[model samples]
Target: MALKPATNPDVEAATIELTIDGRAITAKDGVSLYDVVSGTGKIVPAMCYHYTFDPFGSCGMCLVMVEGKKAPVRSCTAKATAGMVVRTEGDDLFQARKKAVEKHLSVHPLDCPVCDADGHCELQDMAFLHQVTNLANAKQKLIPEDTRSLVLDFNMNRCIACGECINICKDVLMIDALQFAKKGGFTQVVAKGDQPLACEFCGDCLAVCPVGAITNKYSKYRYKPWQLKKTTTTCNYCGDGCQMIVETKDREVVRVTSPLSWKNKWGDRSETAKG
Candidate 1:
């Protein structure tokens, strides 16, 4: 199913006009340039960006050329302004994005074929879209995978440190179970306390991960993204009638997921209790 972009309440209050890639567009005053350009035909590759979360501008993939600026700016964090000129595509922008992807690939594991997120991985898609064949640096440090969680698997080597997992767990889920520890290239997401995992088994972290770094333990090796057929339907168990995307393979249901907005309100409640 094609998901519509969520309306930004700030944009509804006021509107601003801007030019993107030579085409003029009017958007809400405070909305990010990335969100405005995303609605248009322009393609801006953003790995760390999620519409539901506040823009962190962690990944440099959404870099764009703004008029009167020497260096490209991150569209995900840049606010749209009246009379501002933004270039979404160009040879310079392409090279910049390609370089960013190459840098990410340097530390990332080249285990796409064997990874559970193989077919639907954002990093993999960006690498292919930008035609990133070789990394400027090829040295990859080994980081031990975390399998202490019985419901999920954590592979530190495959993480890009986008902060999505940590942010969603902290801000949205209200479960400060995960945190970013260390710095520089050695940074990693770790569960709080001495235990490997110290939060409820809501599996919300797995929903926000863009790579194979976090995945459901039960579905890890079972089915690829393309192998499953998705069906959107209303949840009969919930009074809220939350919509869910049910994934099935060969008539067998593999997994069920709902929008983050829906999950935020009633996610912690049991299925039977919500009915």
Candidate 2:
């Protein structure tokens, strides 16, 4: 099922003045700095921070430096107060984000050529932004592939521990199948036991993963990023999501819409298409 959004519209009433990317703006008291920045159409790399869920700062990809604040704060968790200055991009901020991406890439399986998420992976974009060319893979490249009913190409090293999989499995989908297992270098979220993935097949985790760790087995080697285009429409397949379109070269559909079609689908939630 599609996760419901936090419908507290009054949450934005508590006003605070802020600046992002040299653009002045006003936002609510409790809204995360990430939301404020994103509201302005300024891109700050993020993975785990979802608008509908409580902020989990485990993914340090959205760190932004604040003026008068000694240390950079996690944009996903930090509330925007009155007169706060948030800088999304700069030399210093870039370096800090570079290190974060570097850490994520250190364990990432550097398989952009064959990985299923070659075109639209979030981590891949941020890595290029940070000027990260290649990573030192710690494991053998010949490991056997993981093929399940839906997910495939299981590369444990590609995961950056963004917790999107864990969050979707637990919070959004109400399934506790995926969990963190291990302490340091070998840390990962493997499926529990040898049992089937046991997921609702919502693909919410795949939607939020920063890397290409979890992918639909059926769609593997089927599509590329530049090969498809996202058109405005709703999804008719599920109870969640509005109609959306994927404009492909050969008139083929690539991706469907998610249920969170507030502005993207119907311009508001009240007009959500009945499934």
Candidate 3:
């Protein structure tokens, strides 16, 4: 089953004119400025913003220069308005976004060699995209990994605190299993009440996590992303026939993923709950 948007299909949203990077464009009124920019085939690096939920502008990577604004605004949270002049790219914007990535990398531990999400981490992609190399006062979060959950491991050291996992769990799955809590003098994601994660084990959190903060215990250290050959197939587990991508490594099944993944973040909760 494919998830749909939450808007009414019968009624179309009103359109408004906006200028992005000096190019005039039309977008749905009241929609996210990020969405409008993305519709124009422009990519914006954002960690906490996903299409499945309301924008939580924790990562400042999606900063855009809006006319009359002295500082860059977060495009994900800012709504598109009529006659809005937006600049999505520039040296100043790049530097601002780079600083945001550096803030996360400064506190992050250098564990990509052993991390399961190394090859498929968005943080890695963003860092490389921004050419992040060195930091002035680099400090590492030496918090112990939380392996209490049977299905996943919570490594606070690698976490950027994007809140994507928590938002997806609450907004998309409606499970409300995860939350942000202050632990070890740093804000980290934990299960509600700081207890062992005991939820539906839907693995939505695993899929939406932008970094290796949350990793699958089953596939941990089993294979890198490049070793897996993906085969798109339907799930036979139930009659819902939810589409899934089964990854294999050398004839052995590695991990099974659904359409609901970090890459495919747009979906309606009503449609996804049915799956």
Across 1-275, the per-residue lDDT of candidate 3 in tens digits comes to: 33344322234667678899999887777777877777777788888767777788898889999999999999888888889999988999999999999999999887888888888788888899999998778898899999999788999999888898998889777889999999889999999999999987877788888887888888989888888999999878679776778889989998877566767764432321110
TM-score of every prediction relative to native: 0.84, 0.75, 0.91
| Per-candidate clashes, comma-separated | 0, 10, 0
Stretches off by above 4 angstroms in model 2 are 1-13, 19-24, 134-153, 183-185, 192-194, 228-275
* Better by lDDT, candidate 2 or 1: 1
Q: Give me the runs in candidate 1 sitting further than 4 Å from their true place.
A: 1-13, 183-185, 234-238, 258-275
Candidate 2 residue-wise lDDT, 191-224, digit = tens: 7774457666666666566667777676667777
Ranking by lDDT: 3, 1, 2
Give RMSD to native, each candidate: 6.9, 5.5, 4.1
Sort by TM-score, best first: 3, 1, 2
lDDT of 3 at 261: 70
Model 1 residue 209 CA deviation (Å) reads 1.5
Ten contiguous residues with the weakest lDDT in model 1? 266-275
Give residue 82's error in model 1 in angstroms.
Answer: 1.7
